[model samples]
Target: MHRSAETSLEDQAVDIRIQMIQLGWDTLTSVPKSRAGERSVTLDEATTRVLQEWRTRQNKERLAAGPDWNESGLVFTHPDGTGLRPSWVSEEFARIAARAGLPPIRLHDLRHGAASLSLAAGVDVKVVSAELGHSTTAFTQDTYQSVFPRVAREAAEATAGLLSGDAARQA
Candidate 1:
């Protein structure tokens, strides 16, 4: 519930929306390191539900604050019910990342990380690309190629039984 005083109203509102939706709002709103994320990775269904619930809660707050609850269209609204700005959202993303001891990567790195993590988990590249909002499969593959080695290594480890597993078990 504690917020920085310097925090802009715009960001505060956005934070509220994110909180309400329970989505990885910070991840979805920020641009991605890869071009694909800038294009896609919108709030998933579960997060969408959180947003809907927050929206209802916000509506009640609006009604309590004023009679113009009907005009409150956006999920995140100011005390007077205005839309949140983009810069504020970005600033907060940076602040949170810094606090978390994360590397000083762009806010969008989450998209790439998500892709890398998914690929590592054996999710298909096509799915990763789509989730990352990649325009072409090749681009997705190119950007995430670094993951292939790890992917291969993980696969080998997971199926160690082919050779290593057999030898180890016999011993």
Candidate 2:
């Protein structure tokens, strides 16, 4: 989701309005790839507080930049308020992850992880699919859902428990 520079901190939701795509040397902002991509994502309280602090810091940078500030209306930007290139973000994420001793993972892997984790945490698939901007829950389940061993075992146990309860009730 893209946050506008003018977005009020009072609201903890960001609308997914625009997408930035890189072509050659230029980065262009345009409508999202699909209609489903246009949605709102609500921030948790902790994330909302962090963004509030980041905005304060960014405002200070904007003041320091003076006439040089680009006014790009992005939540994250360079000191001069210009947007960062997507490729640069991905490469930097890799470097940071390596420095933190994490297993080598592409930045996009986080999306898959979020989907899988959300499912494992018992969040509804439809809600997770919507957050991911997937057109359909079937596609989301087919593509992003990974059945972890523990989650699989928990599911089996829960089903057996339900069956046991049914037998007891009948008796």
Error of 1 at 32 (Å): 14
| Segments of candidate 2 deviating more than 4 angstroms | 5-9, 163-171
Candidate 1's C-alpha lDDT? 0.57
Q: What does candidate 2 score in Cα RMSD to the true structure?
A: 2.1
Task: List candidate 1 stretches off by more than 4 Å.
Answer: 1-49, 67-72, 145-152, 158-171
Best by TM-score: 2
lDDT of 2 by residue, 1-171 (tens): 265743556788778888887787788888988999888776678988998898899999999999999988898899999999988888899999999999999988998998899988888999999988989999989998889999999999987887896866976
Tens-digit lDDT track for model 1 on 40-121? 2345566666766765777677778786544535545665565455456567888898999987877567767777777778
Error of 2 at 117 (Å): 0.8
**Model 1 residue 111 distance off true place after TM-score fit, in angstroms:** 1.4
lDDT of model 2 at position 78? 91
Clashing pairs in 2: none
Q: What lDDT does the true structure give each of the candidates?
A: 0.57, 0.86
Among these predicted structures, which one has the highest lDDT?
Answer: 2
